[model samples]
Target: MLGANASKNSTLTLVFLAALKGVVGFYSGSSVLIADAVHTSLDIFASFAVWVGLKLSLKDSAEKFPYGYYKADNLVSLFVSIIILFSGVELVREALLNITNPVGMKLQGIALGTAVFSVITMYGLSKYKARVGRLIDSQALIADAIHSYTDVFSSLIVVITIVGSMLGIKWLDSVGVLVISLMIFKLGTGIARDSVLTLMDAWLDKDSITRIRQNVGSIQGVKTVGEIRLRKSGLVVFGEIEIEIEGDTNLKRVDMLSEEIEKIVKNEVKNLEHLVVNAKPGKMSVMKIAVPVLMQEGLHSKVSGHFGRAPYFIFIELEDGKIKSWDISENPASDLEKKRGMKTTEFLKNRGVNVLIVGEIGEGPFHMLRDSFVKMLQMPEVVEDVEKVVEKVSELSTLTAPTE
Candidate 1:
């Protein structure tokens, strides 16, 4: 926001000063001074260009420019620099011509006072603009300020040279133009260089990148930082990051982590417009492992007693003295046990234990078992004992169809 304000302020200042200088130079018949005034006036166009660039670059990301137009600011800076460069070259040409062909100046107290006033205003304005540019990190605005500062200093030179001429020191006025031209040329080069760097899409300094990594890596659930990329259009910055996390974590967790990273990056990096995160799951070292004996619960006592082996069927009697269902296969050592790796439904059928007492199960196998009519005790974990689980199922069974 400050960046936008700086551009606005620069545009207004440039136009005002340019017009003032032009009027004064034209009436005084100082071609060199008039040239400088016109040069300053041109800043109005450059300032407007910067304003447009800053505004457009801040637009939200779209399909055409996924990263938004933040680079437009850089282009604005380049244009501003070019404007200064052209002005400098033109001023230098005028100064050389004036040196060759002497022009008499009609110096007066009023003219000197006006020049002094212009000098004061230009310097004061440039100083304020420079400070504002620094505050907002605006290269184009800073360039504009430098342009104003040159005008102020050159105005002073023009005044001093004109006064010296009134005192019969004729060569001093031409010398003043040369001095002013040199200053303008130096500032022009700086603006040009900064603009070029922006156009090239250069990354923020290394320190900034490192700081972003540290801030993002500090987020919870983020194990490491893989890639962090940065780009700028006008006043906006776009960032891309790859974060590392545990493999087993779900999508919801990843989304939360991404939001956190975005917040951190935005807080640390000013003018950040868009942040994109790519989550890379941490690799799992152990793919599969076997565990010791598993416990069984919520089954009939008689059914439990047949765990060793027999005709494969065992009836677990309920607490109400009513038998719920039978487990046809009880022996894990039976010949049918050799086909163990089969799906749960197929394995249970071969075991002859058509009924099962277990906790919640998923749809695929549960529906398969229902089709077999292998009456199941869909027990809730609230049941303390295995028998209780079976009883709950038996209690609900009459309301539903029985399995074959």
Candidate 2:
């Protein structure tokens, strides 16, 4: 985008230069010099077209153009080239006719001086434009740079013609015009070809594709870069890529993969815009393991036991071999005593303790604990025997909860 703006500025500057040249050329009465001035003047229009193209290209995607209006930039560039080509051809034809029949038009010293001035000014602008174009990957700026380069060539030829005419070879003036015209025509063709390719939605270079494939495939859990499709609309490189990975992967893992691929493409490639990542499962079967959670209540410990406290926290191991704490609590404790019980579970959960073993909990507390899917080990005192209670609670039947 910065490149586009800079290109617009450069074109505007060229337009001012052309206007100044045209005004001076008209009063100077040098037909050959005036034609060059007119060509430079058209550059102003070309620059305006480029500005419009750049503005449209930067538009966000919409229903009218789902990929945005980037193609407009190409159209503007193509139009500019055509204008330049015609201008050059016309100037050359006129110069040829003038040389065939001597005309009574006096070459003005100011015309030669203007041509020299234009060369110096446009040469700097062309270099600056090309530098910015390369930095921003802007095709319009590049095209403008090409146009400005032609301006330099034309100016130099005009200056040489004026010098030659003063040295008694009047025909050299006509020859200079023809040379500058040919140079303009050649540049116009190159710009036209480049613009046409861009408008045609040409794919990015092979090197870019290779880099994309390598970068995406290098991501963790990405088995291979299945396919990559790219399109350049104006300055943006819109792309869609497929990645193969292990089958039945969870949403979180897939999301991570997508993010990784996007980051790599954006950072590595200039002017990357929209990206679509299609994740495909590999042709291998893999086991789905349940992440384990430890439960406990005060001094009691259970690998998979239920807690009677509400708003309890759960601790689980992450894939990176690090422990993470998750608050499974939905409802805060209704009473002070219940709050204390909740805090106890939190402390234990934070410390990597798993299950809480309790029975006959309050309705709110019980619902909270059960909602987390913790293993509920229920036991009742049998004939006032604490040993029987412990035995019943320790039994594995109907105590363990199913893994998610």
Candidate 3:
């Protein structure tokens, strides 16, 4: 959306300036000014190319283009590059012909004013487009910006040639055209190179990859990170990660760990989306543990003192010494009701909760919970924090050992 808007704005500015320059250049009989005006005219077409690219690129993924239509932008950028290259070659050919015929020019004040205006206007538009391109990471916008900026340099040369015409330098005007044509040709090649690189699916920024690795690796039960694959969907990047788990864990535990890692990575990495995660576990089964909590803080959420009366439960599905998917669910049984403790115990068992960590519990509910294979642990005195509670759970697994 932003790219299309910027391109439209560029087109408006170029149209106005090119018209003004054309009238002045034709009347003043300055060939260099005329060529510069032609350059500005071609810019309108280039800006339109960029706008077309951005529009087509906005299409969503379909059966045909499962990856969406991001390549439309790149394809258009390459097309514009070809246009610029051919335009430069033609301009240079015409300039050589114009140079051979060297016509005298009158010092039209309007021509000088128009040249100055073009330089200033193009300079401002170039800056605007460049800033927008950087903000959105739109390669097409950046390429267009470079094209506009090069026009500013060419306009300055046109101004110089106009000054020379006033001082009896007849051939200097054609020389200006010669220089502008060569510079335009050079810029065209550069833009084409960048566009081709994007079409080839070049690697993304290194910092983004690093963030994905660090964030995913930090998730509990992710023993090591491997084979992080990335692809760009316009400015956004999607990744597929392969992770190895530390101990023998069931598929259920591995699945939870994958979801947990995806959440963590999405939270940490900017403009990154994880499409898939694969976890391979070592030789150990994870113990499903539940910790009663007063509330969920997302990251630093603490455990609660009361087992059945807590407002929420911080459930940890642990594999080996690591925690995966520390989920939080509201404790409906915590509400005042008859046999709420028994209700809590029943709730824990039905939900596959194997272990409960509590600061306090009643004998009736405690005994009932154990009958369902749901073990109980006294919450460590130092386990007031999330990290400490995780440590306590890790300790619980070692103490009780794995049953499955």
Candidate 4:
């Protein structure tokens, strides 16, 4: 709505300026001012096109157009570019004729005043439209803004031409028209290129994709980050991501993980209108199991009764149902005064611990670990030897059910 309003107002302003310049240019025989009037006249149509595009782009999606009418703005911008290029060609012809056959000029004071007024008006209007366009991310309005800015330059040239003609430099008017024509051609091609790219559905830049991947990877239960695709439509961005998870993960857990991923991506990325997350189950070839222990005793450590207060954690790396490697590390958050369970849960997560075996667990840590997708199993009794625990866990058939 803001963009539409800006376009409408600018169109009305252009109508008045075009009329004023056209009348004064003919009376004073200022060819440069007349050419500038033609350019301003074209801007009226360009601004009107922007207004229509912004209005149509806001329509809701229907059966015929599942993606909505967002591309209308790009189409309108392309149309405006064509108008600019056409006007540039016309100006080139007029400049050549004026140069080949110089005409006597009657420089009226009204012509110079009108040209000065146009410069000020167009400069202000250009700034206003550019601000509104950026605020709404409207390409059509931005294109119109560029058009208005070029008018300012053209009008400035008119002022110079009128003053020089009054001082006996009549040929300056022809050269001024030539220069404005070249500038208009350049601006038209640039806008046309951008409009074409957007219409083609170009991918988002690498930095945005990388940031999204990093955010998704930080979430728990995500084993691997797969392909990520994103594209822009008008002012909004749409994305799709593929993620890998444990093969045995339940449907409810998968849904929860998907929701988490969508939430994080939307929060971290700007202007994201929609996201589709694909969570695929992955085969478990290896397992990283963490056991809370009372002390660092290699495979001889005793299981700690309290998860948060455990002095150390023993990590066992198992492959193909066999213990491949084991390591014991002191728990850094064991002696924390507050949030010890939460901190310890984060610590294990950063170490890529997928399974946690404990004799007991506090409610806070239990839920935290569960949300992290860390499989928790309660020991039947206090075990004195970590070696026996490892042997029992290695047997796929004798493993106990996960803790509730």
Model 2, 1-404: lDDT tens digits are 66667667876777777776777767766665667767777777777777788888888889989878888877878887898798788768767876886433354577677778888998998888889878877787788778878778777766766666667566766777787788888888988887887778777477878987887777756777887887777777888998877433446557877888888888766788889888876643222111112332311322222332333333332332222323332323323464654544344433533234343344444434433323344444232322233333335233333222
Better of 1 and 3 by TM-score: 3
- RMSD, one per candidate, in order: 14.8, 10.7, 11.3, 4.7
Q: By TM-score, highest first, what's the ranking?
A: 4, 2, 3, 1
How much lDDT does each candidate structure score? 0.62, 0.63, 0.74, 0.81
Largest TM-score belongs to which candidate? 4
lDDT of 4 by residue, 56-124 (tens): 988999999998888899899889888878877877786687678766567568888999999999999
Q: Which whole-number lDDT from 0 to 100 does residue 114 have in model 2?
A: 79
TM-score of 2: 0.66
Q: What does the lDDT come to for candidate 2?
A: 0.63
Q: For every model shown, what is its TM-score relative to the native structure?
A: 0.63, 0.66, 0.64, 0.79
lDDT of model 4 at residue 81? Answer: 88
Q: Rank by lDDT, highest first.
A: 4, 3, 2, 1
How many backbone clashes are present in model 4? 0
Worst 10 residues of 3 by lDDT: 395-404
lDDT of 4: 0.81
